[model samples]
Structure formats: structure tokens, C-alpha cells
Target: MVKAKQINVNNLPISILDINEDDYFCLTHMTKNQQEGSKIIEKWLTNKNTIEFLGVWEQLNNPNFNSHEFGGIMSEAGTNRFYLSVKQWVERTKAMGITARTGKYGGTYAHKDIAFNFGLYISPLFNLLLIKEFQRLKEIENNQYGLEWNVKRILSKANYHIQTDAINNYIIPTLNYSQKKEWIYADEADLLNIVLFGCTAKQWRDANPERSLNGENIRDIASINELTILSNIESLNSTLIKNNVDKKNRFKILLETVQEQRRTLDNIDFIKSMK
Candidate 1:
């Protein structure tokens, strides 16, 4: 079953229509400014330019787009008594994505990619304004993300030396003396440190003794989201190390991993309640 979520964009609530784990789109109704909205949609429906624009978009993004059905809709787009609704477009043409519904919280919204096109149809000025606002929001979000990441990086670095010293003082002494057992045994905390910081405690201290060990000029603390990623990384790294994989290679592999696990990581929804 598809799960739907309501999200706020520029004070407007939009529904996130998820068809599956991967397939989804945003849906909202057209704006309430009736005269302006109708004029915009009417012009869009009748203009040859609008038809061509929709055609190109469907070709590129919609795998299940029904071109024959859409042709019928386009043919009847501009009659004196004719009417069109978002539901009609979806039902008739299997448009796959369109704005629908009614009431105070309703207005048209589209998938991020398609919304820009709709904005252009409304007015070039509207499109420009929307783009500007969205870009500004994105910049603010990116700056916050960068700050959080750097903070986590510093925390992990500082804890490295402490973890390494613990391992050397506590773990190493407990190991059996065997000819091939010259390696140091890592504790859970050390492993977690490795996952988050991409280095062992001893390694970090050796590389930056002044900061990791001495605690002077240490980096900022991590955000909750970063801590979660670090925790997962540590668990995975622990398993890899137990299997005797090379530490340097494991660090390189983890660095190459993408952060596309879910929207929970990229979006601010998780921490919104705290605010």
C-alpha cells in the first residue's frame, strides 16, 4: 500500500504521494486565487507550447504515461463550456502525477521537477519567485548539514585517543601471548570510534595529539543524525575487522558509501519536534 505524508512548503501543506518504496510524487491543488489560477490553467491547456512542454516532460520522467489518452484530453482542452480537473486528468490519461483535492489546505503542488514547469505556466515572474525561495531554503539547509557533519567529525576524532588508550591499558594485557597474536584487540567503544571517525583512537592521537588527546582546540559535538550514521558505521566496521579485513581499505570503502538510506537522514523531520 502507498503511504501518504503531509509536508509544509512555504506555509502551504503538500501531500507526499508515495506509490512504493521508490516511486512517489507530491500532490496539492491549484492556488485559491481563482481568477488567476483559472486563467493560468486555461492558457496552459490551450497553448500549443504547453502541450509540447507536457509531452517532453512525460517522455523523460513518466514510464507509464499514456500519450494516446493525453491526446484526447488536449483535443478537448479549450471549449467554452468544457471543464478540467486534476482528477479528470489522472483518471482519463493515467497522468501518474497531478494536483488534486479541495478545501482550505488545498492548492496545486507537483513533484519538485514538475512543479517548476507548472510555475512557468502560471507566470514567468511566479516561476522566478518560487525558484528563488526554494534555492534560498536549500542553501540554509546545506549550511546546517555541513556544520553538523563537521561537528561529528571533531567529536569522533577527540574520542579516538581515549578509546585507544583504553584498549592498550585494558584489552591488550588480557590477550594470550602467541607468535601470530601480536595485534591489539579493539573494544566496542574503539570500534564505534573507528566507524564515526574513520580511524582508531591510537591512530588519531598519533596524528593529532594536541587535539584528540590533549583536548585543546577540539572540534564541535555531533548532531543526532550524524551520531546515528556513526553508530551504524561502527557496527559494520566491527564485523569487518573481526574478519581480518585491512583497516585502511575498510576506511576507504566506508568513505565511498552514499548517504541515500532514507529521507530521515536528509530531511529535518526527525528533529522538528524538538524545535
Candidate 2:
């Protein structure tokens, strides 16, 4: 089933349908201000010029368009008896650019291309306003999308900083002479990785071959709760390290911090709302 959306054009509410990511505006909604809107669409369909434009559009976009039947249709155009409905056009030509819909957003809906032609047939002034309103709606959608993307990027950066700070202060300074020579400085991240994930980085990689191959690690797949818990324990672990805490003692304290933060964060109404 297709979902219906609405956009107002000059105080006129136009119904739009989303089909395969393309937008189709309801001609019925466009006619709401008119004395007879359905008749207007029927009149537009009977014109020889409208048929030619639709035929060309179908040829370019629809491989399934029936040229043989379209030839018969163009031949009969502009005759006194020549009349068409959105339904008949699709059935005869196998066109995907326009559709006859039913239920909620129900009515004759045409792609923006054909709908613009109808707008011209209606009046140049009305068509201009229609196009302007659609453009405005598009701009608003783009702005909203960009805003959400920035918010997510901020969160990812915050998590990155928290993890790195913990490793630098708490884990790096404690590296032994032989350990420093054997392991790279970056390996310190695994100090917190083991506390939260219950596995070292190498162990997690070996256990999940598919994810490791895809360039994903255990931390990359962590739940929001785990990341939040990880962020909270970073400062706590750093403080413990300053006091000369041993590895075993730090692990016990960090483990308790993870559980306590998860319990507290999971119950917050606003945080739950975000999830």
C-alpha cells in the first residue's frame, strides 16, 4: 500500500502519493477550488498535445510502454468522440508516469511533469504558484535532513573523544618497558574494550569473522547503552589510575561503573524517548 502526504499550494491542499520514490500529485485535490475538477482532467486528456507529451515521456522512462497501442491512441486524438481518463491512459499505454488511485489520497494523480502541463492548461498564473509551493516544500525537507545528519555527527565525535581521553591518561602512562616495545600506543583502547565487551579487541575480531572482515569491531556494534556506559566509566577509570590502582582493582571498579550507569541511563525518560 502507498502512503499519502499533503502539501498546501496557495491555501490549496494538494494530495501527493509516493510510488517508488516518485511524487504524484492528486488532480482531484487541484480541482477542489474549481466548479468541476474531474471534468477539467477529462478535458486535458482529450487534447492531441497532451497525448503527444505523455507518449514521449513514457517512451523515455518506461520500457514496458506499448508503442503499438500508443499509435492507435494518437490517431484518434482531437476527434469529437476522443476522450480519455487517467485510468484508460494507463491501461492502454502501460504508462507509469501517471496513475489513478483510490482510498485516502485517492483521485487521478499525475507525475510532476504531466501535472505541470495540466497547470498550464488550467492557467499560467495558477501553474506558477503550484511550482513555487512545491519548490518551497522541497527546501524545507532538505533543511530537516541536514539538521539530523549534523546531530548524529556530533554524537559520534563526542564518543570518540571520551574513549581517546581515557586511553591517553589512564592506560598509556602505565605501559611497562617490555610491553611498550611489544604493543603500539593505540592498543590502550582495548583496556576499556575488555571491561565493557568482556573480550579484548583481538578476541572479539576472531569470534566474529564476518563483521571483522567488514571493518567493524566489537565497539562499533555496541548498543547505545554500552557506549553511554563506556563514556561514563572513562573518567572514573582515569581517576582510579591517578591513585595508583592496580589492573585487577581497576577492572572491578570499571565493571561496577558500567552496570550502575546502564541501570541509571536506561530508566531516564528523555533517553528512552530518544531510543
Candidate 2 residue-wise lDDT, 109-136, digit = tens: 8888888888888889989988888898
Clashing pairs in 1: 28-108, 29-107, 29-108, 30-107, 30-108, 160-201
Task: Give candidate 1 misplaced runs (Cα > 4 Å).
Answer: 1-39, 77-83, 102-105, 175-226, 229-274
Clashing pairs in 2: none
Best by lDDT: 2
Each candidate's lDDT (Cα)?
0.54, 0.76
TM-score of 1: 0.56
lDDT of 1: 0.54
Scored against the true structure, residue 97 in model 2 reaches a CA lDDT of 90
TM-score to native of every candidate shown: 0.56, 0.65
Worst 10 residues of 1 by lDDT: 21-30
State the displacement of the C-alpha of residue 113, model 2, in Å, after optimal TM-score superposition: 1.5
* Candidate No. with top TM-score: 2
